[model samples]
Target: MSFSVEEGEFFGILGPNGAGKTTTLEIIEGLRQADAGTVEVLGMSPWPRNPKLLPRIGVQLQASSFFERLTAREQIRTFASLYGIPAKKADDMLTVVGMEDKAGTPAEKLSGGQAQRLSIACALVHDPDVLFLDEPSASLDPQARRNLWDLLRSLNEAGRTVVLTTHHLDEAEALCDRVAIMDHGKILELGPPATLVRGLDSATHISLATGTLSLPAAREVAGPDASVTDDGVTVTIATRAPAPVLTALADRNLLTGIQVRGATLEDVFLHLTGREYRA
Candidate 1:
């Protein structure tokens, strides 16, 4: 429930659905009143509706839409005008987000990724000190999502403080300097992704997918403590030393897939929360 994002840090808030992330963002954005507790952003209190802080902060909601008839350039220009900025800066902002090629395209005709980039352009048009994005990668394809990640990193490198929420644990691991895992309006874990994941009981995970017939022998080699997935096709061996486990499983030719990796954020979350992350 309490955390602070350092200046120029790419902070991320990660949680499953209905984890109060949206409400938390709204409160910090000065769009909603909090029942109790102090919320400070950019060294200014976000409560009581302070006019001076609004202009210094930028926010892009999970879903963003512009006038259907307006081209991407026009939409950005309109926002620039609202912010008392020059129209020429719209083109500059478009280039920043890789939307210059689509500037002439209407908002209604733009792809999901293009539209999201335009929304980000609008958020940056005012030149705010701090930017907040909620689930910015939602509905984007894998390639588009990765592209957005690159854009966000570039923004951070250019000296912007970005706070975002995401359902993808991999994104949290790759993009965020520090991540807070929240559930039911409370933070269940908080730390850098590597530190949090490394705190798990097992240092590594050996995952293998096999048929029901191989489950018995797989568990035998994996030991009594190995975890068998609910579907029984997947068996995971957790240990710091995976050599013996790997050697034992190598003899079995029924494995459809096998992988050995360190404990991940997802593994830690499942251990802590006793459930899979649902987004």
Candidate 2:
């Protein structure tokens, strides 16, 4: 329920449904008011919706409604005008989000991914120092999702702070410098994805299909987080360094049909919440 993001970091909020992801984002965006406690963004309270702060922060919601008849360029220009910025700023932002080629396309004609990019363009048209996104890649195809990641990374590199909420663990792992995992309206874990995953012990899961051998507790080889699951003598162990465990098991001729895989953000999530990131 509590965490702080460093300026200019790609901070991600991750959680399942009913985990308060969108509610937290809405509070940060100044669109919703919290009944208790205090909230701040960019050095000012957000609940009151400060006009000065509005121009310094950009927000892209999970869903956006655009003027269907307006060309993407026009929509962005309208936002630019609202901020008293030059209309040319719209073109620049569209280019920044990789939507320049589709600038003239009607909003109704753009695909979901393209429209999401346009939404981001509109958000950035005012030259905000911070960008907020709620599930920017929610429905994007794999390639589109990757493209969005590149855009976000480039924006951060250009000195814009970004805060986003997403359900994609891989997205958080690949892009966020640090991530906060929430459940039941509480932040249960927060840290760099790599560190959290590595902290899960083996940082790798080894599954071996042994024909008829029984092995010592995985906890003995790895640690408490290490465990074994059996399917016809197949044992799975979660560990940080597999070499030592594998070598020790090999000494007993207990290794068979071994498979090794590295840990991931998904594993960390499951470890913390005992549930999948279905939400």
Candidate 3:
């Protein structure tokens, strides 16, 4: 619920549905008013919609809205004109988001992912010092998602601060310098992804193709400290000590279909926020 993002830091807020991620972003972006706590962004208060702060920050909401009947290029140009930016800069922004080819396409005709990219371009057209994105990649396909990630990384490297809210744990791990995990409008944990994952002290998971070894044989090989389970498709060995188990598997030639995964951001997130489904 409370944190500070250093200058040029890539900070992420992660949570499940109804966890107040969107609401928090809205408050920080000065789109909504907060109830009680004080907020100081870039040494400026965001509440009451400070006019001086508007030019320094850019915001892309979960859902994008555009001027009626405008093309993708027109939509961004309009945004640029508000900040006294040239049309050329707006065109360059379209190229930056891979929308140059679709520049002439009507806003209503753009797909969800394409529209998402356009919205990002519009936000960046003004060359704001800080950028805020909420669920920016939710509508993107895998390839598009990777492209957006690359774009964001480049922007951050250029000394722009980025504050993001997303449900994707992997995105937070890949992009965030630090992340705050929220649940029920509260921060449950805040740290670098690797540090938080290590703090969990969780077990390693070594999975093999089902029937590679019988359940009884696997139990015998893994020893008593390790827990083994098979749900027909895969046999998983959960162990704090993986070296011995891996050696055992290698000795038996059962490593052909093996998969090994250590604790990750998702593990820490689920541990803190619970595994139940959220609508």
Candidate 4:
């Protein structure tokens, strides 16, 4: 739980439900207190609501609420007022989140994705240096999620430090510069996704179409410790060398449509935590 997030870096915390991911983030954001362990956010203690620090960080909780009857622009204006931000600043944020056209739409009328984006826009209206996003896209559709990702990338590219928690492995792989895998209130792994995946002893995977071959023959082709799925065609070889298997299949002219690919973050997570990234 003790780590530092550098400026302009997209850092991710990943874990399953009730794994303390949200608790850890809340503690860091000063929304909740930790019984033990010291936390310094942006070099300032989060407790006691440090006035200097509060204005420097923006937070988007998993779920945020506003006056249900207020329009998006009105909600933005209300939040901006809390930070003493100008009205024009709120308008700019609305434009930034693609809610400009829907500025007049009431909070209760917005689609789930639009509301989430508006919440993010409100958080960013004050022009904070750091952003905390907790499951920002958890309930969003695929297209909406992609849109949020692009917006986040733009924000990071403009030098905003973002700390994100998500269950989506692919999202983390695509957006995070580095990630810490947490479970049971402790870090199980921490590194760039590619480096962590490459560090696994099981580095190669061979997938074949199901019903395209025999399990016994495929297992014979693959050595012991190789895992063959019940479907009988997808075999994973946990070895540094995959060329030999490829060569063997080629020699026997049995390689047909076989694919060799590097391990993914999901593979590394499964190996380390014994849990699947279902989301």
Candidate 5:
């Protein structure tokens, strides 16, 4: 329940639906009040909100609202004017988000991903020191999601602190420097992706394709503490050590098209949460 995000770090908050991810972010963003917990962001209490701190942080909510009839350029310019940001800087932000080509296009005419990028552009128009993204790539296609990931990486490289909420385990593994896994309003786990995934178990996975292989025979050959599953040709062996299994299979002339791999975050998540990360 208590945590801190260091400067220039890409921190991710991950959880399933109704896990209080959005609620926690809303509390930090000064949009919601916490009854008991003490919250500090950049050395300021986000609840009794500081006027100066508000302008120095950029926030992209899960959903946004804008004048549908306004062009992307006009929308940015309007936000800039409200914040007293220069017009040229607004255009530059639009260009940074790859929306310059669509600047003349109305918000209603923009695609979901494009509109999301424009929302992010507006959030960054004032050059804030901290950025919050709430499921920024939720509706985006794979390539568009990658583009947004690259943009966020560039922001982090430029020394901006980013706090993001995501349900995509792979995206968290790829983009986060450190991740906090939350559930039921509490932090269940926190650490770098690699460290967390490696903490699950000291085992390697070996997969093989042999066309309707025998699961029981494979398990017997894999020895104790190892498991084998066969699904009509595709076989997967989970073992604490792969060398012994490989040797046994080789000795039996059963090791063909074998591949050894390490555990990933998805595997760890499934092990801990008892559910697949579908979002």
Candidate 6:
């Protein structure tokens, strides 16, 4: 519940449904008041809805609501105008989010991914010092998600602080300089993704195409301690001692399509939060 983000750092907050991720973001963004704690952004209080703070931070919520009957271009221009930004700056933001081609298209007619891009463009139109994104890629397709990732990276590299809340562990791992993993409205872990993952006493997973090696053969090479599973399409072996298993597989010429994966942020998340569905 108590943590600090360094200036210009890409910090991520991760949690399942009802875990207070959005509530935390709202409080930090001056949209909601905290019950009993001090909060500061840019060395100023946010709870009173400081007008000065509004111009320094940009927020893109999970559900974006654009002005009625506005095109992509007009929507962002309106947002820019509110901050006293010029129309040319708004147009540049559209291009920044790759929405220039859809600029003239009505917001209602844009696809979900395109709409997300527009929302991001609107948030960035003012060129705020900090940006807040709540599940920005929640419903985006793979390509759109990757594209958004690139855009976010570029923004951070340009010296803008980004505070993101997402359920996608991979996105956090790939984008954040540090992350906070929360559950039951409390932060359970906080650290760099690699450091958190390395602290886990978890097994490495080795996988291959199903037909490449028989399950029985893989199990034999993997040994009794290692767990092996074949789910038709892929055969996976989980082992604490992967070196010996890999050496055995190499000796037997059974390494085709082999993929070795170390512990990842997802593993760290599941270990801290437990394996259960969240509403």
Best by lDDT: 3
Return the number of clashes found in candidate 6.
Answer: 0
Clashing pairs in 6: none
lDDT of each: 0.82, 0.83, 0.93, 0.85, 0.87, 0.92
Model 3 ranges with Cα > 4 A deviation: none
Q: Could you tell me the lDDT of residue 111 within candidate 3?
A: 95
Clashing pairs in 2: 1-187, 201-240, 202-239, 202-240
Instruction: Tell me the TM-score of model 6.
Output: 0.96
How many clashes does the backbone of model 4 have?
0
Cα lDDT of model 4 by residue, 1-279, tens digit: 677888889999988777788999899999898898799988899986788899999999998897969999999999999999999989999988788999999999998888988989988999889999999996688987998899999999999999999979999999999999988788999999999987887657777776555677777777675665644545544445677767767887867787778778888777867755534
Pairs clashing in candidate 3?
none
- lDDT string for model 6 (1-279, tens) is 799999999999998888899999999999999998999999999989999899999999989998888999899999999999999989998988888999999999999889998988888989899999999997789988999999999999999999999988999999999999999889999999999999999999999898888888888988999999998889999999999999998997877778999999999999998889886
lDDT of 5 by residue, 223-253 (tens): 8898887767678888897888888878877
Give one clash count per candidate, in the order shown: 0, 4, 0, 0, 1, 0
Ranking by TM-score: 3, 6, 5, 4, 1, 2
Better of 1 and 5 by TM-score: 5
Tens-digit lDDT track for model 2 on 1-279?
A: 677878889999988878899999998889999878888787898878788799899999989999869999999999899999898777888877778899899999998888988888888888789999999986688887888889889889998899999888889999999999998889988899988887875357787675434555554665565566676666777676678888877886767667888978888888777755453
Model 6 Cα shift for residue 141 (angstroms): 2.1
Models, CA RMSD each: 3.3, 4.3, 0.8, 2.8, 2.5, 1.4
Estimate TM-scores for all models.
0.84, 0.81, 0.98, 0.87, 0.90, 0.96
Q: What is the Cα root-mean-square deviation between model 5 and the actual structure?
A: 2.5
TM-score of 3: 0.98
Q: Write the per-residue lDDT of candidate 3 for residues 1-279, one digit (tens) a residue.
A: 688899999999999999999999999988889998888888999888899999999999998989889999899999999999999999999999999999999999999999999999988999999999999998999999999999999999999999999888899999999999999999999989999999998999999888889999999888899899999999999999999999998899888869999999999999999999999
Worst 10 residues of 2 by lDDT: 210-219
In candidate 1, stretches whose alpha carbon ends up further than 4 angstroms from where it belongs are 208-220, 224-240, 247-257, 273-279
| Stretches of model 2 off by over 4 angstroms after superposition | 207-241, 244-259, 276-279
The predicted structure with the larger lDDT, 4 or 6, is: 6
Candidate 5, which ten residues in sequence have the lowest lDDT sum? 270-279
